[model samples]
Every structure is written in C-alpha cells, then in structure tokens.
Target: MAEWIYEDGIGEARAALIEDGVIVAAEIEADDDGIAAGTIAEGRLVKITVPGRRGLVRLDGGEEVQIEPLPRGVTEGGRLVVEIRRAALPEPGRAKLALARQASPEAGIAQGPTLIERLHASGDAVRRLMAHEADALEAAGWSELLEEARTGEVAFPGGGLRLSLTPAMTLIDVDGWLDPAALSIAGAEAAARMIVRHGIGGSIGIDLPTAGSKAARQAAAEAVDTIVPQPFERTAVNGFGFLQIVRRRLRASLPERLQGDPLGSAARALLRRAERTPGSGMRTISSHPGVIGRIADRPDWQAELARRIGAPIALRPDARLAISGGHVDAENP
Candidate 1:
C-alpha cells in the first residue's frame, strides 16, 4: 500500500494509507503539547476497516484506520468506512547522564604502558545512572529525613498520602507501631504538602497517631493529592497504621557528598589535639543536621579537645559550625 504524509502543529496528525488509488491504512504521530518540553511523536497504527472491502479509507480526523477489501467499483456499498483508534505511546521514565570510563591494564591511554592520557573516556551508563538516581532522590522526601533525624520518629500527618521533597532538606521521624490519628482533611493535606517539599530522599516514617475513624483516614488520603505540586508513584497507605511513601532519590544528601570533607577533617584534628593537651580551657563541638531530645545525645566535642582549641566547642544541627574572634555561632545547636 502507498503511504501519505501530513504535518500539523495541532493534536496528533495522521493520514490514511492509499494503495493503487485505494485507501488502506493510516499513520499517526503524536502532537506537540506546545510546552517547552517540545512535542512528542509516538508512532501509532490504526486500521480503517470498510465492510466487505479489502483495504482502508483515508480520514482527516487526526487518527488512523484500516479496512478490508471488497468487490471492485465505487458505489454506496463502495464508500469507505473508517474507525480511527490510537496506538500505544512510549512510557515515560527516568533519565540520567554519562560517566567517565576506566582504562585497560595493558593498552593504557598513556604512552605505551607507563604514560598517561591527557583525557579520560566516558561511560554513558554510569553518567545516566547517576543523573537518574539524583533526580529520584530529590523527589523522594526531604522534610521526612529532617524529621526522622530530629525525633527518631515523625508521624505521617498527611493521614495516608505520601510526601515528595527537594534534595537537601528532609523531614521525617522514627518508626514504631502506633494508632492512626483523627485529623481534618485540610490538616492532612497541609502535612502531606509540607512533607513532599522539604523531604526528598532517605527513610521517612509517618505515624498517623490513631486509627478507627474512617473520616480521619479519608481526610488524610485526600490531603496527599491536594498538597502535591506534581504527580507521584509508589505512594499508598498500608493496612497497618502507616503511610508508605517512596519518592525518587536525587543526588547525594547535602551532608553526604557536598560538604568539603577536608575542612571537616581538619576541624576534627584540631579538636583531638586540644583534647589531649589538658588545661587548654578550650572546647569544640560539631553537629550534622539533626536535633535530638537531649543535649548529651547530640554530638559534641570532647572536653580535652575543646580546651586545646582555646575555646568552647560545639556542633550545630544544621551541620555547619566554627569558632573564631572569641565567639562561634552557627545553625547547629
């Protein structure tokens, strides 16, 4: 059969297939949504079946249809019958970047087997995997991470909805068996939204606080949809009193990959030396991004180290801390 082509910026466009001056099938292309993401073209095939006919008919309704063959000649019985249907579209999923490649042992990029190459090869899989992983982490849950770190367990205020979050700040709490709580739909929704925006990656457990009232549970579930700025996957409440949420993990957490390790190492060394010196009257402390129920439970600098450093030592909840010019204050506590 002969093929036809037509391009329109509107909804998906397709043209009926023509063979020997007779219509047979239609071809389809996805239309542009007119967004910055650009138009998507998904290949589609629709059969345009005509009664008693052995071919198809060409339709201009932006769809494809195939037909069957019939007796020769044109008439009311010869008129082409068309039924347009859409074909399957490609599934949308994660995307990632490429990575650098490793060199072989014998044929190294350097001169012979001993020299070095000015550049490095790339690994598309590694790059792509890293990129997708980072994205997934960011969308997972940020506030949940923070909440868990702070209190060991944070209840799922959304009632049943899951949370999404950015990469850095996560809010979550410790986990334990608990009854679901009774909360208004509005309250549940607010909690859900907050959870998604602040908590991206890491583990998060939401305790509903009580269970028993169907209205409360329903309200919480509705809140999840209300708070979400975007759609989510793997977000569902379990039979237990917990709301199970798995957001995409983005890149490494702020405390994990970004913070300069050298500086932290140096600070710890300074503290250690101070601690051993004795009578230094100095103290130092460092903290990651969590606030605990007790001061002692919070990470602290050894008294000896603080004395050697020539001042009080401390770590803040925000993970950044320092001492200079007499006073040191930061986000950590």
Candidate 2:
C-alpha cells in the first residue's frame, strides 16, 4: 500500500506520495505566496484582444486573467466574475493566468483541500512527518533531477536527449548511439520518466533517428505508452522518426518554472540542505544575492523553517556566491 508523507514547515507545506516506500509524487507550497490556481474571484473586464478570442479581466485583488472563450456580452470596463483555472507561476512580474469558468459575483474565496489533505481524504493511509522528507526525495540523485529539469538536457543509458521549449510544443532531439531501434526505445522510456519527474505536460514532439521499419517505430511508441500515464494522446512514429504526444497540463512544469531563474531552484536546494542536516541551532543558508533577496522577502517562510527545525533560520546574501553553489551551515545558539 502507498503511504502519504506530509510535512508542514514554518513557511512551506510539502506532501509526498510514497508507493512501496518510493516517492511517486511531491508538492510544495509557500505561505507567503498566495494560492496560485483554483480560485474564483470577481473582476472587471479591462480589454478584449480581438472580437471573441481572449479578454483581460482584472480581479478585485488586482490580479488579472486572460480569460478565453470570451464571456458573452462583456465589453470594456465591465463587471466580470471568473475562476482561475491555472495560477500564475512565480516570475519577475505578473504571470499569465488562464480562467476556466464564469463565476457568480457572490462566490466567496475558493476553498479546497490542500495537496496533502486531498491525498489523505482519498482514503490512503497518511503519515505526517515531523521534519521534511528529504531522504525520500533525495532518492536517485535529487541534484541531477533538479539540474536536468532546469536545463532540459537529459541523458539516457547509452544516449542523450535535449528538450527545447516552443510556444506550441516541447521538441525533443535524440542523439548518440548507433542502433536506431535501441536508441528509439531508450529515448521513449527516458522521456517518459523525465516528463513525469519534471512535471512536463502539454504537447511534446520527439525526433528520433529514422527507423528501418514501421514495426520498429510502432514498438518504440508503445514503449512510451507503457511508461507514461494515461489520459494522454500520442501519434505513431512517422517515417522520419517523429512522434507527437499531448498530455493535460495542470501546473507550471519544473523546467518552465526554473528556466530563467536558476537561483529560485537554488533556494529550494538550500531548503533541502537544511532538511538533511542532522543537528541545527541557527541554520544559515548563504546564497547568491538574488536567492537571498527572494528568501528574505518571505519572512513567513523563514519563520516556518526555523520553527520546523527548532532553530533560528538566517539567510545570508553573499554576492560572491554562485546561485547554484551555496552552503547550509549551523551555528551554536
């Protein structure tokens, strides 16, 4: 049976779905950041892009969503109610939000169980962790996963694949190795695991070396189906060894979230460091200036981390440090 491990930190809340003692899914949320998605709000229509394609709706709290299927009879500067289907990812500025449905003006704040809560309510045996489950998350080289997710360059057992993000789809280029059939099979399996590990979804295109037979191509495509989760559509490998797959996208993929912000990923890395450290008094995570700035901005997160670790948490901004390179050290109280 699968067990759910949940950790409620001072500033961050994390949940992991562990099946057979291996973590299959993980989620994290910060207290300082407002819930990104699954919220309904009242807003005012600000602008309409074209006649019926998309419209900008500003919520009462000043957030805005580019609502699609443009609401009927809605004009400029009109009262609008919408449910935020997708939350804006954390970026330099406002994130583009996708609205799902029209809501009534009387709808209050969207309420729903958190990731961990939802998992518990699903009738699974849930276990609450007194501390962060870094060990479980660290399985199979955590650093490598984070780095790969950030770079979108992944290597298979005998080959490699580079994933490129386009506005329309994620294009993957597979190379290395001599056997086309073996390479295609390897690429398909690796890509499927990477997609799940990196939380990749939506449209995907894989370009493999031209195979000799349609049977070989079909076999490769089947490998992907066997590994990847359901509710996704895939096309058979073409003559040129091209396969297109589409999956439902819910949240920002790890690659998409950390593409431009290495320090953001670094900050989370430091949190994992704190989690792994055994003894702690005043735990200080010295990081790059940008990373420090982000952590400092979230006092609630700092407090939460401190409380969870039973120590004072300090974030030191060292301009000399690289974003991805930092040390988590403990000081005597």
lDDT to native, each model: 0.32, 0.72
- Stretch of 10 with least lDDT, candidate 1: 111-120
Winner by TM-score? 2
Expressed as tens digits, the lDDT of each residue in 56-164 for candidate 2 is 8877877667787788888889887787666555443444465555676577766434666666776878877664454654553446666776778988788998988
lDDT of 2: 0.72
Candidate 2 ranges with C-alpha deviation above 4 Å: 1-4, 9-11, 16-25, 30-36, 90-94, 103-109, 121-126, 132-134
Query: Worst 10-residue stretch by lDDT in candidate 2?
Result: 87-96
Model 2 backbone overlap count? 3
Pairs of residues clashing in candidate 2:
10-304, 11-304, 36-87
The reply for model 1, stretches above 4 Å from the true place, is 1-194, 202-204, 253-333
TM-score, cand. 2 = 0.85
Q: Quote the positional error of residue 329 for candidate 2 in Å.
A: 1.0
